[model samples]
Target: MTGPLHEQSVLVVGRAGGIAHAVAVAARDAGARVIAAGRHRQRLADLYAGEPDIAAEAVDLTDEGSITALASRLGSLDHVVSTASARARGRLGDLAGDAVRLSFDTKVIGPLLLAKHLSPRMRQDGSFTLFSGVAASKITVGTLAVAITNGAAEVLARSLALELAPLRVNAVSPGVIDTGAWDALGDQAKAQYFADIGARNPARRIGTPHDVANTVLFAMTSTFLTGATLPVDGGEPLT
Candidate 1:
């Protein structure tokens, strides 16, 4: 008899990010065929170069045509994981119309389009996992776009879960994972920032990409878990 995740085909969006890489590796390790999608061709190519079990595709989530094209390539899927998000950090009033549109398009509209195109192709036992951030719950200045998008994504996941039913749909809200996205920050600033937040968190440390990845894998395999927003934030929400 096959294991729970064996022989399943999983499609992962935003495959260039650290968390997506971790999830791809974990899904592959669990005997699933992983198809990683993103807008960065070289990054996706580099990621799949050494991994025969993993495949990579270049996709722009902001374009519905691109998403539909990707769906065509996928044909059928047992799981879909979206780690895509727009990182245009700015104050509420300072954001340009295009910037706001880009942010909303990638975070909210992109996943919705993916679901619209892929839902019919997904197996009844299949599942979808979308990524949100702790900013949705935590009040942070200059993160209005992110917070709004995260909140909307979570709500969309819940609604889709209800509609999809037997096909589980969920979102993972992560906090302060040490990914390369923070490499641009000054060392002192980064250290102080994480140190302060970690101290407040009940787990007393920042989460890792693997931490979030494992939670996503759990959502994929969990037959009974649906419409749940799992916070893989090292208990930061408790603070």
Candidate 2:
């Protein structure tokens, strides 16, 4: 509560992703010890390859046993953050069951299971930050699954916050961030998407990874803040 997370340890799930990687790096720079977990062993390794204070662990959050094992390995935890998600964009009727299940598993079940397993290991003053998305509050045609899952995540965070007491719990909802994830869309589609969102947002630009990362860092350090869903969406919520 005094120093800048120095000597503290943080467990970041889905650290291979752009936003998650930024968060891990920022936390480490602030003098915190970081343990990053993701399914991609090589990616996780590459992320923290030379970082002395960072450790990378490959984990499959979809499996309850895997989550439990990971939690068990971290005997004690000071902070927990998750950016896990199985994002699939498709029309409602065209979407497959597997895709929907994948989305739910990562975005909803994974975070919940992680929280449940890691709760005991967390220090009384520790914190848990989960990832949600603007889709939860904004309507988009083909992002139905994502929206639903994110909304569920927000609700879960709120409920967990109350149950966890002194262990703060919250969700960070990011807007359309310029992470490599958007590369999946064609240049034309991506341009139009960004233009639309940017015009609507008061900030007048798409968000950056740092925008979300800063919010996550703030949530982790603000001891009195709990059960909050902070939107790092470039003021997109105003629209």
Candidate 3:
């Protein structure tokens, strides 16, 4: 089970499923102790109950106090990957102020607070891997809120990389991954959407959770790579 992260402690922040869960599994397999934290502690705990190497905890990214508490509880960590996001989809006219605010609060400000509180406890070589998305680069019509939030997240990563110094900071921007995130479209529609994206994108297929997870693992181990937004979008932005 030993790998690049052997014996290190990794914290993954997000829900029980999707890309965050994939990252946690990858980190654990890489021989790191994984703490899966999110707003719902019990659910995450239940999800990873069988894994001795993965522990589940609670932290609300929107609340700085919660982030502080989690940092205090953990004391020290080797790496952190944040995949939490609240998407505010739809055109400008259909967007709600609250939804847009929640998107920024969850994706951007939350990660900033995590860095503020967690960086002190991290090793000088440890890194932070935040999640961005293709929306930031592609700039489509129905995803204005998502694009702006993701763009801000990239900037935040770069700024943190400089401000945090020896502690590295980076981002993973995924494209149309076939996760539950698209389940809202229902089975039939989701399939069609994936087909359309797969055909249009250079990779000619939708991304998998592992596609993004592998990148996060690389970010954690690749000390030289910092302040960069690595895309796991199957080259979607190019097309």
The model with the greatest lDDT is 3
RMSD of 2: 1.8
lDDT of each: 0.88, 0.88, 0.94
In the order shown, the candidates' Cα RMSDs to the true structure are: 1.6, 1.8, 0.8
Which stretches of candidate 3 lie above 4 Å from their native place?
none
Candidates sorted by lDDT, descending order?
3, 2, 1
- Model 1 ranges off by over 4 Å: 1-3
Best-performing candidate as measured by TM-score: 3
The C-alpha TM-scores of every prediction are 0.95, 0.94, 0.98
Clashing residue pairs, candidate 2?
none
- Give the C-alpha miss distance for residue 9 in model 3, angstroms: 0.6
Q: Which residue segments of model 2 deviate by more than 4 Å?
A: 1-3
Candidate 1 lDDT, 1-239, residue by residue in tens = 14557899999888576899999888988889989999996899786898967899878989999988888877789999999877768897887778778878988899999999999999999999988889889868998888888898899999999998888999999998998777778898889888998899999987889998899989999899999899988877667
Cα deviation in Å at residue 45, candidate 1? 1.5
Model 1 TM: 0.95
Please state the error at residue 227 of candidate 3 in Å.
Answer: 0.7
